[model samples]
Target chain A: MNDERLERYARQLLVPGFGEAAQERLGRARVRVVGADAVASAGLVYLVQAGVGRLWIEDAEDVSPSDASGWLFAPSAVGSPRVEAARAVLAPLSRFVSIEPYPKGGVPTATLVFASSGPQALASAEAARRAGIPHVVVEPDAEGGALVVVPPGAPCYACARSTAGAGRPAQPGIAALSALGAAELVLMIANPESTPGRRIDLVRGVATARPTSRLPGCACGGPGAGAT
Target chain B: MSASAPPRVDVRAYACPMTYVKAKIALERLAAGERLEVWLAAGEPVENLPRSAAEDGHRVLAVEPLAGAPGAFRVVLEKGAGAAPEWP
Candidate 1:
């Protein structure tokens, strides 16, 4: 680590069990962040500030007027590609992190999915599970949101997510959930053994988490599971 | 056991957390039972470092003023064998 990096990450390095080794893991991580919107802006900024080495943004939507209310986009950036606009803002936050659009065949060490819909989250999380990449999925509802963290051998997102939650109008409070989601990913990346698979629900200002269990017949438990 | 010459870090130029941060990193590089010497500015850095290191399970061997540097102190810490903090 360089002198500047030591200074930049000094606070985190002081965290118990998260020293040079954890920082090295973070510096070597390639993270794929799916979806780019107001809900994802906080996670994107946290990941960059926490020093994830490479970040690939994978959203297909353009920045809409609603996105202007968030931190990553400006009112003038409406109609621009969401991923591009996100990169423009996120790139300047940290010099150590490399921000780019997700490539056609790029392999990510881990993934953070902020899908706009249930089906999208399912598909993205399933792909990450198949690839054996640890991942966290953010599901924001009207009240607050939930985050599903799936380590390599844990229950998959489909088995863990609540069945009834649906998309809601984006609000500023959701940023707290987004930041929590980023912290989950950081813990997963920094200390995989210490972070287990779990589902965390954020309601109002309270947060609750529980271990995730695989549903019967879920592919995550079958032979050749996570084989890709 | 006879005392060995421990690795030293000068953190007088930094402030509160950085002082402890540099000392912690230096301690992380050592094995349990090994000692580290940290030179920090007086006041908060001096007041907090030994307490924080002890809270993190390290042993505060000694804390005293530097021989020639006024308003500077040296802290000696023995690394502990405890595991790092895990997620909830």
Candidate 2:
């Protein structure tokens, strides 16, 4: 690594187990971020700041007025495509990371899904699982949010997600939860063997994590689990 | 006693965290039982680097002032056999 990069990632390098090798892995990662609105802004920032090399933002919707409440989108960007607006804001955060609109057929080494709807989250997480890639899913509620981390060969997100929480209006706490989701993905990418599949629920201010278990008869436990 | 020149890093220009960061990266490049020499400015850098390195499981072999460089010091650290700390 060059001197500038050494300086740029100095703090992360100080983290135990997160030295030059982990930083290099992050620099080589191609991450797909499934949403670009308020809920995903913090995660996108965290990923870029942590030096994820390439980011493909997959959001077809246009930025809405509510998106202005998030840190990444400007009021003027309300009418533009969400991905484009996100790329604009995220590009300036780090020169090491390449932010772009998710292209058709682009393959990501990892994924972070912040889908607005349950169906969207389910589809994206399932696709990532089938591809055998590590992924994190953010399910934000008014109280806080939950994150499902699925490393390759671990339980799928569907099996890990909580069925009790109903989707509610986006609150400020969602940003913290989203950032936590990014941290989970970072750990999964940096130390795959040490990071197991789990679910982390952030309620109010407390965060609780539990190992994810395969629900009975869930396809994730079958012989074809993680099969592409 | 047998002796070998250890890998050296000069982190005098960097501040807290960066000083240890540079030293840690240099240490990571070495194998277990290998030694790293870090040259750092006095005060917090000198005071904190050795402790931080030790906390990360590396052994602090020696910490002393560099010859003719007043207020500057060198730290020798021997890499340990323990695995790097795991992430949550």
Indicate which candidate wins on lDDT. Answer: 1
* lDDT of prediction 1: 0.88
Q: Candidate 1 docking: what grade?
A: acceptable
Please give the CA lDDT of all the candidate structures. Answer: 0.88, 0.87
lDDT of 2 by residue, B1-88 (tens): 1348888999999898789888887777777888998999999999999999889998999999998899999899998889374332
Q: For candidate 2, lDDT tens digit of each residue in A1-228? A: 888898888888877788788888999999999988888988999999999999999999999888888778889999999998888888988899999888899999999999878889899999998888899999888889789999998888888887866574557888899899999999788877767888999999799998898888888888967421
lDDT of 1 at A212: 90
Clashing pairs in 2: none
lDDT of 1 by residue, B25-64 (tens): 8887777888899999999999999999999999998999
- Regions of model 1 farther than 4 Å from truth: A224-228, B83-88
True-vs-predicted CA distance for residue B29, candidate 1, Å:
1.5
Q: Report model 2's TM-score to 2 decimal places.
A: 0.94
Clashing pairs in model 1, backbone N/Cα/C closer than 3 A: none
Against the true structure, whose DockQ is highest?
Answer: 2
